[model samples]
Target: MLGLRPPPTAAAEYTLGSPRHPDVRVRVHWPTAQRPTPAETGGLPVLIYFYGGAWTLAGIDWLGWDRLFRERAVDAGVIVIAVDYSHAPEVQFPAQPEQGWTVLEWAHGAARELGGDLDRLAIGGASSGGNLAAAVALMNRDRHQRPIRLQLLEAPALDLTLGHVDAGGVNKAIPDVILRQMAARLVTQYLGTGRGLRRHPYASPMLARSHAGLPPAVVWTAELDPLRGDGEAYVTTLTRAGVPAVGVRMIGQTHTSGGLRSVVPAAEHLHRDVVSTCVPSTHRRWTIRIRCAPRTTGYEPA
Candidate 1:
């Protein structure tokens, strides 16, 4: 349970079961709207959501994020499918990535049954989940399979290299040694072999040989996050590959704020921005815009 509390919002009824992959389990969160008849849902898009927890702790029910995600999907007139990829230390290395891809594959066929448009699909996640989202997008591209229309990465940890601190100008409060140790543990566990740190595109999107032909991307970065540099570098890489990308830097926030979207207006706005970016012209063209408040005693932009 991770000692986390349940979301305050009313959750829709759904089911949890093994996906085709015996090792991977999926938790589907249905939208609150009445299920559409087959005739009524000929082309509704779906958003596949991945949750962030440093690729270890946390689950589908942490905070009210899932509820909010479903709400956003309903409001955007899309179906919301959340995947529960196996975590690290037990499942390790490429498991989450593989599980993520597997879930995406399932969503394509499953969306129709759930009354969604498989052709207009999108993927999104936060932090570690964001890392998975980017990786999966690359896999979809490299394999010459599945067309992803959009990608939403919120404060993604795109770089596995140890020297990102100097490049990103991370906050001084995060101890350098501790950061390295955590990264080392993650690499060792996730790859199952230390060789996972070799910077494979499947493991690290930053290492991908090409970002070309990938879908339009919406990347969110926190002004106070240690992973800020990786997100910026990713945006640059995407642009170089000619992929339409938008990067938004949230001021006065940290990586953890994403999980608290229910309580934070800024986080809520960030979620809305991601959904707005994914959906087709339902309204005005959505662009990543930065807003800042005057710095006070303890707040400053990175």
Candidate 2:
């Protein structure tokens, strides 16, 4: 359960759809202050966010994610558009990423009307949502050249194969073997019976043969999360491929630690780090300084 609060700014709701796909519900949360018109001043950056729920739970209306979106819109001074993508075991794999790409296409076409900066657009998500965000980034690269400036992944589940999961790194409340089994089931449920679907770049971004030509990314990983290795390996792969990427390992944090911001002080710090990352920086340089000791990393422009 989460405490409900009034949204920090005005939000507009709409539905986006294509003939082949189901209609996707979208909610756009505006920052408290915005330029009167896009003609006078380029509008605020837009962050198209997806909520995490292992691909089965959570929606744009989930109280936890709603609060995060509102906070990000107000604090980062951007237009936050949350996508309620179709869930798994029903919609499955490529459908979710397809829906995500549809939103990106709409944003590009309607940026001016929505008072958003086309060039400063970004996408982000947590857990399974992160998988979709990365998948969408790959789709943008392979399908069309969308001006997506960044991909912000928090506690992302990048490798659906579950090969990179280190159950021992997860919280010990549940046994490592059990955690491994649970993870396997989630992956199986989302992937369904499709053969070799686990290796599909849209289903598992880390399995993509090439990480080059994708937008710059800011990846956040919890030290105690079983998926931490997935995030670490992804950052390494992206960097080696000559993409601008940075990873921050939050020390002593777990997979669900992000939802503990109300009690855990460090969680608030993570929020600030994310909000700062959302802001459009001059020179197109993006950097995240790890506040936690012995585990911090950053990107400095050359």
Clashes of each: 3, 0
Model 1, position 256, has a per-residue lDDT of 76
Poorly placed runs, candidate 2 (over 4 Å) = 1-6, 33-41, 283-302
Assess each prediction's global lDDT (C-alpha) against the native.
Answer: 0.69, 0.83
The TM-score leader among the candidates is: 2
How accurate locally is residue 82 in candidate 1, as Cα lDDT from 0 to 100? Answer: 73
Worst 10 residues of 1 by lDDT: 1-10
Give the C-alpha miss distance for residue 213 in model 1, angstroms. Answer: 1.5
Please report the candidate that would top lDDT against the real structure: 2
TM-scores for all candidates: the values are 0.81, 0.90
Error of 1 at 294 (Å): 21
Candidate 1: regions farther than 4 A off = 1-22, 163-171, 282-302
